[model samples]
Target: MSTLALGVIGNCTIAALIDPAAALVWGCFPRLDGDAVFPALLDGGGADAPAQADGRFALTLIDQSQSEQSYLPNTAILRTVLRDSHGGAVEITDFCPRFALFERIYRPPTIVRRVRPLAGRPRLRIQLRPRFDQGRLAPEITRGSNHIRYVGPAQTLRLTTNAPISYVLEERPFLLDRPVDLLLGDDESLEAGIELTARDLFERTHDHWRNWVRSLSIPFEWQEAVIRAAITLKLCQFEETGAIVAALTTSIPEAPDTERTWDYRFCWLRDAYFVIHALNRLGGTRMMEDYLRFIGDVVEDAADGSLRPVYGITREAALDESVVPHLAGYRGMGPVRIGNQAHLQIQNDVYGAVVLASTHAFFDRRMTRPGDGALFEQLERLGARAVALFDQPDAGPWELRGSAAVHTFPAVMCWAACDRLAKIARRLGRDDRAAHWRGAADRLHGIIRERAWNPEIGSFVSTFDGSEMDATLLLLHEVDFLAADDPRFAATVEAVAKTLRNGDFLFRYVAADDFGRPRTAFVICVFWYIDALAALGRRQEARDLFETVLAHRTPLGLLSEDIDPRSGELWGNFPQTYSMVGLINCAMRLSHPWEEAF
Candidate 1:
């Protein structure tokens, strides 16, 4: 129970990861990329010690018997119900309150928990441990009449509650005749009665999310799953700045002892494009619009008209990679790395993501900064960069550091950039510019057809002059670089299926990466393969595989970034935006029509 399972709760300003028992194992303060105050998810990894207590905020129920978890119907709120053998039950509701307020989005840096006695009186203890600088230090706690303020170097946190402060502080069980409301924030005081304020906040939070879910264009089939995935993706967004992070926690390994852990708490240009695409399909346009502004800021500030693969939430350019020396890694795996070095890699695919993501602004009338002649000029610079780097060797989409190649994935993205820019040019009546970009696209298309294709292997490879294959090549037909019906595409699909596909999952690549060969399957790649299968008219098989992957999601109907292929166990960062986007996209593409269901 010490290991952090995949239940997550957030309100866009911040998020927390927990287990089924509702232990706060992993989360940051202030924002997604901030310091990891709860490092137990990493430090306590697979430790089976019954007394797990360090670096966690959890309800320590005394005389606990049975526990289970679920979400508050169509909301991001998490409910963990614990029952004692003596016929007493308690329900713990965890969420970060957010709703429309002051004619704007009200997403505060807060985490809310409400404990209620469901049946008879229940006894529980609250274990609250606040840390600083990724577990390198602890914050000083100063007590107040109704609250305790934990002042850290970076920020301050307040826990205001109705529960006895001494009981909570000493980790002693107390009878819960009624509900105890707790609010963790720094902005304001809850001078009003705790129960009254908490009840009102929970109601508003519930109403806000249920209404937001109502606005989604979810497929009729798998509606519940799609709704949950959509909520998780929205939670991953930093609404204040409109930046969508890849994942919440950092240094959760992709595979056991593989050294594949990464800090996914920052936004990546490539990942955002797919996120925008998935949300667009589900009719979640507000998120797309907010994210566009985030991307626009990055694009507008591009150094020398070139874009990097990743950027910080506040659009910070420099993210130096290092390890937190004090904390043990997730599952006792040491050397928990902080920050990311991929910021320095040459990922040419980002140029395409920039143009593709911005293309919506031109046509979507609802955009705040709708595309204009000036914006098109700004985007053209990115297109030119894509064309220039189309055939150059850089890090592939997987961010491989040990080697470089003229990867097929980035090459096709470069083609997509030219293709999209040409269409945009034509839309704006710039016929000359249209001709130039299209000509570039046509030339690159020819080059990819020639070099990326392996005549001997009877399929397209991961890179030009390479027989090696990676999961990203599954997207060849997705970008329209090749038609699904094209025999070449079919052969490429079969080739990747033979080499990278293992059972229902697909490996990113079997070739040894920086940490040696990957031992787990990336869930999103399987989604891409399923989409490809559906496109190729293998609908039934695709649907079956899709179901198997769906069953692999965490109990709370969410997914992490990676999964153990050998044991079918979930791993890596929590509530991965990429994985959730895959669920939404696949369900939309493969589900039976609403009319058919009826």
Candidate 2:
């Protein structure tokens, strides 16, 4: 008896039965970076359309019973477990080409599909459909008995079959049971096949991942979470320019009915600190070095000193947000956007993050000669910008709406900027600038302690005059603004723990005037708790809390920006890099206690 299971959501999904005899992947394209060929995942009509309408492809696996899915340890190569009811099993591995390192690179995109059946004899069925321009435009189809070519407005898609399987153009979903192999690309023919066993492929994939993971020097306790977080971090890095995106998808709401959806597909300067810290802990200094190089390139390429807070994956500073009204958002969030308009905002804190991250790189011995010089120049220019805007009001760390106010966190970050620059300048023999930066940092710290800190609340305020507590203040110890053991620090931590801690997770801030109950715990705040716990000599508690957060990771080992404490469903964008970065930082903090390391 054959039971068919079809899963359709967004522009990417897989459908198969429990036994995994045959599986179908729809909406996948030639490459991970390319647009979807089967837009059905985004629209219901595309899923019902014939594969030959344009150049869309459906992959089918046959002759298997049970199926499971996982990643190759620390890599993005997805491994699917296929087994027969009797006991035979196989594993299929899939990964898109990285940047253009492969022998054949498609201009648009191409997806690589490798199938192997283990134990018992498993037959596979494959289908290819290459849709163009979000499946809105049809392509000119050139059909052959065993091959097909689809030429579109800007790209060409070709599919060739190896096994005998009937190619039909029906208007509804159908099943293909026979062995069929096909390739989809512009001018290239991807090798497709149905192997009797996936043993060799599994072994190779396993070894590749194992070797890559072994390159990391993570401690034992945080190994699993670190590895997973590291892998997630790698997935967000655009290989072409080494720029890491904040998230993969856009329009996933931070809160239901709050209209908090924002595109996170661009690189953020704010992420620099967490990325560097995490990579440093993982002993993966290469990424930090690459980031420094990218920063230098952007500075050199830019016509002026005006820097953007975010940039495209290819290091392009231009990012204009536009909604795709044609398709509905995930779970009907509405206004599904592709690009981010946040780049247009002048976020002063980004300067501090960049300076702090560069300082981390320098101290970690990751910055090379010319890059060091470039970093110095960058710090100089950023210092000038910070000083010029130190008293001005602009978008703060939260990037809030309504008014651009003098945010406490951004001011603190500006302090970090000056502080890091002071140290670096001193090291580089620029004593005069170093002294100026140090004075600036000292004055900013004094101002924060005076104006931002609320004596009644005993914790740092969210804004300069706001009495509310912000989780971003939890980084006081992280940025060395205050000693972890300082009485004020202890008081602030206790205050947040009492007011903001919702079970193990923490809220971003507490609004004294809010009407509704406090929202779900922010995942990043939970990580901040772990950091604070570690800093406050609560090692065991920090470790336990860290594990508790890990338990919230989705079945596929992915993390969203937030999670419903009641239902435990993921909220916000899937696979958030910030969440992963927090995971990595907490792990490092737990593994290496501050007292001993600092």
Candidate 3:
């Protein structure tokens, strides 16, 4: 019931993270950026153990012995089949319905749970525990004929169901004779029969997602993984404003007692850029197009030449970091934080991220808002910021806390900004601006080549004039900063492969920063290394490593933000979009051609 390997179901507006055994352990209300109404996953009795099943909403099969779970292929709908020793079984189908209604997508902040007896007689107990105000207050409940209303300080939640209301209120076991539907969301009366309405919604939602997945230009190999990752990534996007959250849960420590737990519920421009870019490869342009609005608003709203690394999903600019003392952290690690502080720090990489994301809007003919002169002018300011800070000391992409250094990764991203700007300008027929940005790119590239390369170490170091190597350099060829086989880039990759590599994973960096040497691997960095390996013509080795990494994924075929280097156990936040993007991108890079599949 407390598995970290959980399935996520959402409707672009709201999301719920359910354990393998059909328990809703973690989920926010209203939106992805909202407060956690269920934070049991953050307090699992002290040690690094799976959460105790008490604080979550669960359907316990009284006669059940074992269970099996899977998603309805190509959709976010989850199916958990609970089987008892005496041949009694029931199937629980969970999802947040999202499909086209009247004229627009009807993605409400709602969750639909449908339970049906599959074989024999199945008895089940229902437990619904919902806390409010960031797990600080437990709401009082009031039940009517069939719906239950839970009213808290600031919000109210209503659950309309076909199941006996008294059983839900008293947590009593009931016999399963027919189907029952549990719909939780806005306080509204059901229009049709509960079970029938839920089934219709499920069918429509399934068709919507399946049709969407079919539109993707997926790679030939690992089609299923790619599709799931793609779907999860899409669900993470807040459709209201086109913002993408990094992950579902927050304050899940990067390592045991490392104090590296962070709030990833907000939108990080850098992370969203990577997500949009990855989805773009699959011909998923709608996400990109929607995100373009977010980017434009961010750029336009900038009072000065600076933009935040992260922001509130609903366009709230400021997010001051703080902890929730009431709810113990994940695994009972204290200091469950609410907001992120990286917003106030300097991160030059966002300039390039914005520019990279903006490129699609300008050049892609299918886009609604193709880049025009005005948009380009607004972006020019971002390009100028990148040019100014390429060599300045600030927080790098890794967001080290203690000190700021002229990290090579963000510097190269700056180069990418100007370089991409020049390309966009050329496409727009602005020869003068193109030449200007091209000159700036060349200048930054020259600086990086001279300052970042350490001949003594025979590699491109993480920081300028420093010797420590990190996995970020694995992206050298990815950004076109260096060619795949460039001797210097090749040697840098080899050096990282020797130093940062750990079994099938790669530590983001080896050196101690603010805290100390990282105890685990940043999972995405390993996929970056895989890309580096494949680029180096180490196809067989890359494939071997890719398979090894895939084996480490949780049973649900998903990964967390961080992985214990020694145990290969998922460590950080659950259902990390970064890790999922890695899965899709690596699968695209390493999988065999569709032509050969026949």
Candidate 4:
């Protein structure tokens, strides 16, 4: 059976997910949100469907017996070792080249694969299938002596390789007598020899990642985990536009065989705020800077000073949700989706999320272009929107399709927006605006305190005057909505723990919505709970739960959006940015100080 036990390789512009057997199962070309050239991750179909999907590039070791996979330390390069039953073995290295060149970063939308013989002459079979139009059509293929081009309607992919073209084209098994190099990218010819070019790119890319990792201020204890999570988050960023995708792929369901699937290839302000916050903790402000640029464009384009919950990577506003009927979903599940309907949602929290994400610009001296009075003026408009919509009914953080509520989380986020704006105004010496935003924040806080608290339940609920609790409530202290020592905050934490906690995991909510009750635990909520625990001085409890959450990560120390509470099986999109951000945040929060450890 297929699983999300995969490793990711990317250059911040394009990304691919490879399975343990060194199969390139998922990748988008030309850009991160572009057509998936290799879409086998979502092409598993019914009994009548072909046994092997026609959207992947698979390398099989003949009579394979065992395989192992790992990443090079402090880098995104993945290495897989496969050994056959008859003592033949091979090692496969996969990565996308990203390095400094010509005074700027050179990150191409390319994937490089190096397969070398390890022990005996390993027989290998290559299955290279490239699909287009959301897996509805195959690309037109043309071959040259040393390269093959897969031409699609929107983009063309060229593969330059020194491997036997005949064996590769015929999908025949062949002896791995010597090392082979394959470069798959834009339809461009290489100026240097394939072997030398691949080698140089590999060395430079390796050094680039190592240097980047060295610059992070990772926690002393969980340094490896933090570094991997940081790199995964960085990969989700579309560096060209500074838009950070919530995840790389779309339509991977949160649960099996459900309509809960949605595309995560676009940027969500709420999710991006969390990602920026986590990366900021690790001293990676470049992503935040790029994202602010994306935000500036969106703000300038919004004539009415209104912002959508999500936007396309290039700041395109219309994201009409569609179904790709031709491609079966993961594990034979159906209804693979392309665009996200959440772009049309009234996720009111986004106003505060944008403000929260931008607050760093005003205070951090490291920013090249610090937030100025002009930027503050633009953000105040978002604060006004937050004030107007804070208590209104709309889709909550979970993005319910059929129901709307005046969610407490969004209301609190609105308060945070105003509160942060007040601080920003003070930083700019705009006393009048500071006082105005301060009053606005105080009034909203009082309203939330009065209406959102359920006296009968002895805790704050998901919505105003509601009686249910959700995992997002656990963020009260983290967002400064409530103090950790406050009795109300403690009670709310207890309420969330009692209502949503399942075994060792925490569900986003227990209430059923449009499809049905959610069957898997939202991974980030558990991390939020751990943070709350640490803040409440339950260090031992927080550390124990943190370790349990770490155990659910894949072999490469990556996580997805959701996981089965009972089985610990990962579901949802692979290498979810939200889940990885949660990992880094929790690690930083829970790790002992380096001085104390020393």
Among these predictions, the greatest TM-score belongs to 4
Give residue 34's error in model 3 in angstroms.
Answer: 0.9
TM-scores of all models?
0.98, 0.83, 0.97, 0.98
Candidate with maximal lDDT: 4
Looking at model 3, which ten-residue stretch has the lowest summed lDDT?
45-54
lDDT, model 2: 0.63
Candidate 2 lowest-lDDT run of ten: 10-19
Model 3, 298-397: lDDT tens digits are 8999857688888888767788889898877776766788889988888888888888888888778988778999889988999999999999998898
Error of 4 at 283 (Å): 0.5
lDDT of each: 0.86, 0.63, 0.86, 0.90
Off by over 4 Å in 4: 45-52
Which is better, 2 or 3, measured by lDDT?
3
Off by over 4 Å in 1: 1-4, 45-52
Please identify which of the two predictions, 1 or 4, would achieve the higher lDDT against the true structure.
Answer: 4
Off by over 4 Å in 3: 45-54
Q: How far is candidate 4 from the true structure (C-alpha RMSD, Å)?
A: 1.5
Candidate 2 lDDT tens digits, 127-198: 444466655566777766655677877777665544443533322323333322233445554343323222
- How well does candidate 2 score on lDDT at residue 261? 68
- Put down candidate 1 lDDT per residue, 1-598, tens digits, no spaces: 3443557999998898877766788778888788788777788453342444567788867777888999999999999998988898999999998999999978888888999899876788888887888877888888877788888887888999989998877777899897888898774688688788888888999999999999999897889899999999999999989999999888888877667778889999998668878978888888999999899889889746798889999998888899887777877765688889999999999988888888888777766678878888888889889988989999999998988989999999999999989989998999999999999999999999999999999999999989999888888888888888999989989999999988778999999878777888898999999999999999999999899998988788888888877788877777788999999999999999989987
Using TM-score as the yardstick, the better of models 2 and 3 is 3
